[model samples]
Target: MLFERLRTLPLRLLFSGSVALFPVSTWADTAAKVAPDIDLKEVAPVPRPEAKAPATADQEPSPDADEANPVPGEPEAEPAPEFVKTTRFSLLGSDVLPGTSTRLAWTPGIQIAGLSQPTPVLVVNGLHAGPTLCLTGAVHGDELNGIEIIRRTLYDLDPEKLSGRVVGIPIVNLPGFQEASRYLPDRRDLNRHFPGNPDGSLAERIAYSLFENIIRHCDMLVDIHTGSLKRTNLPQLRADMTNPEVAQFTRGFDRMAVVHSTGSDGMLRVAATRAGITTVTLEAGESHRIQEHQIEAGVNSLTSLMEKQDMISRMFEWGDPEPVYYESSWIRANHGGILFSEVDLGARVNKGEILGYVADPITNAQFPIHASADGRIIGMAVDQVVMAGFAAYHIGTEAEVPGE
Candidate 1:
């Protein structure tokens, strides 16, 4: 009985530091017998495989899962929205926001004895996006008609309804305007120096400043002027029609005569055109004093041009279209004396027609000045004086005229 009890003991318990003196079947029987009332099934170890915890319904998937498991035929995610940008218009360090107007005084670096002169600038920025038009007057300071024209034009503009911006410089040559002369204090023609050199002469420096700071901002330009040196021009446009853009600009002035001429070197129009800006010159009455009729005509023409460009919503009424003359000549005086003109501007004359005559008060002699071609009188000399070879009349010939 003692040997049977010893053999019935568990071999695992005996091997875990206690010596086993029984077989395997005997050890199983002994373990069953030892734990009979202690429940032997509870003491046995359980076997299981490794697994992850189940996710709750409210939990989100990992980033790797989102990238790996894309929905079928679904587009990629969109980027975040960006901030909106607004348009701002500025000139000569002065900002003119949309639907607003401002005046800027531009002073170039060129000075006389430590004194700088400011050129008057008027800017009107529109509420909508569109082209920029630049209007310049009094390039020759003595040309007062353009100054008045610009003033009247600016006075009538409403920035709130305008489609684009308009920049007006009523007086470009301040020194000449103050002195009532057509040139600067140094006697240089300011209009002749354009796209000027920064390190060049005084006139050139001024031109550079104006061109770089003011004109370079324009997509289109209109340079207003009047006849120079005691001469009067009928309302007309002078432009180089070789450029289609310039030709279109000339057409904007409905009833004004257009004279085709490539402007001289260093001229503002020429320089601006070379830099890809479409430009035209509007010539009106004579210089030194303002002519009411010329000023009125200039104002109307500019208004009509703005209308054509869609800068303004108002529709301007224009008269019958004028002729476009490709060729014109000046009728010069043959005798030196006091002069009188029998014909007025815009008068049509036949070949050899007597438009004016020169009278010599000393010798009581008179000479008739006749038109050499059948054309309209576009420009004439002032009635004050006459000299041999003086340009007395300008005839706008129909020869070589281009089709409208």
Candidate 2:
């Protein structure tokens, strides 16, 4: 039963065991314009340090030091190389420049404004040129896991040793973040407002500004998120494995257990893909709460990614080289009542297993809910009262279909 359950579970891509975000493609294509190449130009490279002269053996041996210290023929310690660093280039029509590992809030150019409020972005620059990695968090606002993860990562990475640039935007939907809600103040899903309109609604303007100023600038991206308030999730990755380049990057996350769907509309990953950007999602913990392990995993995973980018030399030790994959789905409540989940995050469940039970607090009657397919329980609702058609739990397997 356990093995069968594992086979049916949906795969959630865990970013260091953390949760994951965006917009649809058509709109992004129209609104998210990359800064003109004129904004950047080649400059002279910095000179390297001169080599020191070799020491002469006969020059001097102190009678007392000869016995205590090593001979002059012994190799001397090498001098550390002096690295020339470049600053992050300013975005178009704006003079804002991000410091190494610092998060910056932005105000887009008139070309990007549907209205005028600062759009937030985080930037971490590398000492040398390489890929620019942009990570967007909390696009839905309620997905708090990414917000914390991006903040901590930006605060921790040292730019002096970085190989490529890293940009993090912890909360793109400032209004939604402020409300601690999923949708923006406009009551629209910011994720659905992708590649927004500078002349559109409040949400559209914000989305358009981000796409123009931030998303279009990066070569790679990782959007972070979490399960909704009522549910909890196990970590996993979501990527469009159909694209060879994206599949390669997706395989880089040593801990990712699954590769789920990315064909949906108005999703940031889909938009990025259409724009010829490599993007993926990382799912970690529940909404509105901090999970220490999840945070640690996210930071470490990103650092390891930095290492892979040759931005840094340090490596983090995680688990096995490969992870399982699964297709997943949510099980909605058939009846209205309080829920008592029998399975926890990462727990395996079989078809017909009593994964949880719904009870009417007033009537004190219980109704057991079963898994329709074999898989692991990646997410479950914490809220006891569930209305019919309301999602109660999420299940998935790590198995890849023959062609998927």
Candidate 3:
């Protein structure tokens, strides 16, 4: 019975692990935007360092022996290149050298019309040794903002100066992306099949392939996403704040709202966290369209993360920190009709304040939708027709929600 209940839940509800189902609607015309092609221009070839000349044995030794041996007050000699701890990062059977970048592809066993498709991976291995940070986007194919965010972030990075490595998968669902659909050709949601089985369904095999090959190598993870169809979300980070490590990860994204959500089953964040990897999900804008503001914010947040990790030297001033919301609730529409929103995203609201109204077009009657609790609007439905019981406004409240 539990399995049945979970199986019947809508894909949007899967984010919050809510069992209730609502009518799922999307803008069909907005789905055809192609995933942006990676620009090779950003990755320039690194010039080799000049080799130092070795002293000849015939040369006379220095007159001052104290000059050769460092005194107590003198600075110590730097470690030789060979002595430096340099790690050769290997992924998908390819070895990526320090101060360079490479692309790795993963192909599942299943083929569409007998043609196998490969997922593109971008890896930048820095010269200095440090942690491995993984950046993934477009887990749900229709979510395009994350795809752009990953691309922009990767483009701005320089492996020659970076202390750690950054691995990026710009588009995780090629088939769904190609079809402009949220699910695979089999109509299965790929986000719900993490750490998947090799012998299970097609989505499971694909998930297993990703987990074993790519995800397992990460020390830290930031999975980017956007709101579901017909819904728009404010830029925020969702993480399990109870865990010290998770809380630290949340703090890395400067000046961004942090929402505490101990992600649901089969989610990449949850699975990665179980594997002892610090993980967080970045939700911004909405699906099917690329919003420039959201994309820029996502890029800046990632830059902030790298700065926090001491992976790079560039310091970004992110003004004033945002609060971490522990409790949140969705205000459902009480009447079905054409909806108009009075409040904007991220607007503060008090208890019983009117957020929007549902109007009967035929009768010209309007029903005011009031907030159940005092909070800020973290997410809301775009101005459109809505049905009764539809989640219209997602408010981040001051009260802590149970089990969160």
Candidate 4:
């Protein structure tokens, strides 16, 4: 009987497992007969494959997913747009000639330095499409090296071979240049006014307009100057070589005598540099007069710069240039008197050499001025009488020389 019940029990239990319960009277009798040796702890529920859990707020993102599909609470990355290349936008248009280059000019404008006086800037264009470069001269009216330089450079160039545009303002400060004075008609130093106010003083208006219009339009600039009033200088290029691009472009000026001048604030070079232009300042000859050697050197440097920039295809044969690179200092007069120079401009002098003698005109007493250090006499006073603290000359010394 028991064996027969056991065989049928599983069949009944399989279908009735959810609700199956024995009656109390029968379950008690069955429990008495059943063995107590079976272990419930030995049996474990079988583990089916776990279903995937829903994504949570703190879930990490997958590596392959696009950044746009960022996980919740993730910060998105935003990048700035890339820079676009510029095209030829010259004020002056060029005539396209077969197998030749293009020539251009700046849009002429009147700079109101005073109520009655006006200044003009002449811009030149090139045949090819490249960066705009500005060549400014006669900021100090007496410095004529750059004025003649621009003339020769323009007449000599052909447009068909040019790769970049050149903007030449032969006389930036026309009033000063015309009057042969270093300052404007207002007696204000034009170099000192920078980023000028358009509605401000006479010097300021010109400075403001120049900064806003032409300077803002160019990518590079070259400013030419001579020594202060009576002084002179060997043909040299002054620039900050710290910038990589400036160094690259300027290095092509083979005969350029490089000077590492600590540029003054608000000066033309400083203003141009601050405006992101690589600026080159050339100091050549004495004020009011142009030397042939200086002019030759200026032409060689200008051509070399233009050629290196691929502004023109014609390569110039420049003789070897000895670049005396230096940081410079000036020697000033200690006392006011009639002056007699022992050494002339461009001459090399040793320490203690009698540079000049200052004599009291009324007393007829002489004071001998000696060279403080060994250096080249880069500049000197043209006028014999000088007041104390007046800058007589600028000396280029050994220490002034650049190491690299």
Candidate 5:
């Protein structure tokens, strides 16, 4: 019932920074241009203050008295500037000072027979103030690629040189993760419940707790995921370009294929956007396993995104930007048979190009699936036994990224 609490939360939850992004006319144009991978910038450590020599016994140690205790008449030293851009900020009920990082626990209210596990939240509060970017992975327990991406991105950061905060939740659904399943113990999809109902079901309650405690703290969010049901997707951004705010932030990613999607009801991206958080879903590789190439690609894009946000400065290679797909459709099997792919992921095809084929095992009947439009394959199922109308291939029609 308290789902709309984002608007009512303390104003401290709203963060600001000196570097605000300009409107993105095109997704590809949003990043700094590059051909071959090369480092152009570097992260510098914070300069330490010089240590003063020890004073002799005769020479009285003179510390700055005025700095320690100001006179009562002298205007109360401006009380930390009331939730301003920089200074020590409080999060998760503690003051998080600049140039520091900490681990916090997110414990659910209920503790019934090992069902509730307190998840660890990694926070890196930087030396300077900027937008807060949150990276979440494994909303689905079977998804392993994202878990590694979050770990590598957060661990590689140096808090002393960071400009903004990076909050990483490596795994959100612990119940599902522990069981190696995609849903909760009760078979509820955790990703489908967001900005959840406090008095609702188990999934809803957990969703509400996370959203209220951690999710709202972000200025921007990228929910990491992998293709479900044995499907694999190219590293891409799924965003609702319809929102002007959403379009502006999607420009931060490097070389990710942008797919326009508003997201389904109760999804984290949709709820966060409704609550005034700029959000998008990042999908890479397939579920239930980790691929090195996919993980590297994901990590690169994420770091590139951070640099574009000015959160951290570092030298890194930027790949050529991929195209934006305005429309996409899944090519399904027409007959019950074993499926085999003829084209690889990211392969371009003509309207009538054959993508894959389905063959009936008992009877010698083979059916080929063709592209309905001139586009590239963005997602597809792994070769396996299939029934009639199983989604076999997904193709996306390329289009120019929309301007502001």
Candidate 6:
């Protein structure tokens, strides 16, 4: 019902309640070559920031600031992320020299009886160094939106014109992606393991390998994901605002909604954040199928983030920023049955308003599901049969919303 997206832990992952893209050709050749970049139209574009004030005569631009609180009239801009061109970069035993791209394979720590299929990792090492940015998708095997997102984002970069490196692992869990299932063959949820143990469970080993070898290579990370368990989300960022660095990292995306969660234990975001790598979980659209708008929004957002970090320069037009939800909860179903949502994702609701209803298919008895508090619907169950106590509507509030 939510993102962290463990099918078994919806309620605990919820804030205070019970439960909570790809193309073909340059669009479909995923396994063999670097994906072809598609033309993406920005959902809401933000023009490039105006030039920053010059440094004083004796001073140079400083890149490390707790928060470069932009001065009112003549504010100094936040230093763009820096990369050392003198350093060499390598991945999975291969040297990726500057101005070049490589398609490499990463075999997980999992060892099966016969042969294990290797996962593909794409890398673009830029000519002018900046930072290594990692884009991971399909941690949940059934979620297809992220895989497509990684493809579009990675292939779009030109090594010669790029500043930093971009590494994309479209399918982190190949077994789940191959079977189109959310859980691994061992019935374990891969999302629950992070910075894994070499001598631990299979899921743990895989997590450890990725975290150690792949994830550690990045300056910042974006773990792309979508809604789970027949639910969907408006394009948004699931980030822990308590961490100063993590909080500031949320500002790069163009007007994407931010949901504050210190994040559940063992999630890649929490582990990576703990590892001192600024990371955020991006939740977009639903699982199982490809959604066009979601992919475009993801591509645009990633592009904007790179530009903000001075990794790329794409002047995307952006809208007024969206508010960050400090608190959120899942409004669960009191009666299990065929649930019909009366409201849509991002719909504003008043306290006690009927967001949807559950109707018994047999007796035709119906019960309306009302909001426990005034808020906006950020995620909800699709028109499907759900059981009592099932997380049906996810309401996010920035301070009691509009209604009392």
Model 1: per-residue Cα lDDT over 1-404, one tens digit each: 95677578653232221243433352233221110011111222221212223446898533111011112233432211111014346466433545655555566655542344456577777767788999999989899999888878876777667788888899988888899999987789988899899778888988988898889999999899999879999999999988888987887786789998899988999999999999999999999887998888888888888899888878577898888878899989998998899999999999988998999999999999988999999999989677799999999975444553
Q: Could you tally the backbone clashes for each prediction?
A: 1, 41, 0, 10, 0, 12
lDDT by residue for model 4 over 1-404, one digit each (tens)? Answer: 85576466553232221223333343233221111111112332231221223336799533211111112232322111111012223232222111222222232123321233323333344445666777888888888888888767755655335566666778878778878898988999988988787567888877876776568778888888887767677777777766656656667686766766658877999888887888878888888887788888887888888777767767478667554545467778888898888777778888888888888999898877887778777667775688888787667764333345
Q: What digit string (tens of lDDT, one per residue) describes model 3 on residues 1-404?
A: 86798578652233221222322223212221111112344452332222223336897523211111111232332221221123556666544555665555555546642354456677887778789999988888899999988888876777778788999999988888898888887889888999899789988988887887789989999999888868999999989988889987787897689888998988989988999989999999999999999998899999999998999988578768787789888899988999999999999999989999999999999999998888899999999989999999999965443344
For lDDT, candidate 1 versus 4, the one ahead is 1
Better of 2 and 5 by lDDT: 5
Candidate 6 structure quality by residue, lDDT tens digits, 1-404: 43345545432122111121112233112211222111222221221222334457898634221111111243221111112114335566444545656566576636441354557777787777698889999999999999998888877887767888898899998899989999888888888999888679989989988888789878899999999999999899999887888878888898689999888888998899888889999999999999999998899889889888888876678778787898899989989799998998999899999999999999999999999888899899899999999999999987421222
TM for every model, in the order presented, reads 0.77, 0.72, 0.78, 0.68, 0.78, 0.77
Residue 70's lDDT within candidate 2 is: 16
Residue runs of model 4 more than 4 Å from their true location after superposition = 1-88, 92-123, 321-325, 399-404
> Candidates sorted by lDDT, descending order?
3, 6, 5, 1, 2, 4
Query: 1 or 4: which has the higher TM-score?
Result: 1
**Per-residue C-alpha lDDT of model 5 across residues 1-404, encoded as one tens digit per residue:** 34366356433332221212222233223222111111112332232222334457788634221011111232322122223323554455433545655554565453452343456566777778788998899889889999999988887887668898888888988778888898977789988999898689988988887888788888899899999998999889999988988887877788899999988998999999998889999999999898998899889888998998999998867777678898999988888899999999989999999888998889989999988999999999999999988888989999987762
Which 10-residue window in model 6 sums to the lowest lDDT? 63-72
Candidate 4, position 199, lDDT: 61
Global fold similarity of model 1 (TM-score):
0.77
Query: Which scores better on lDDT, 2 or 6?
Result: 6
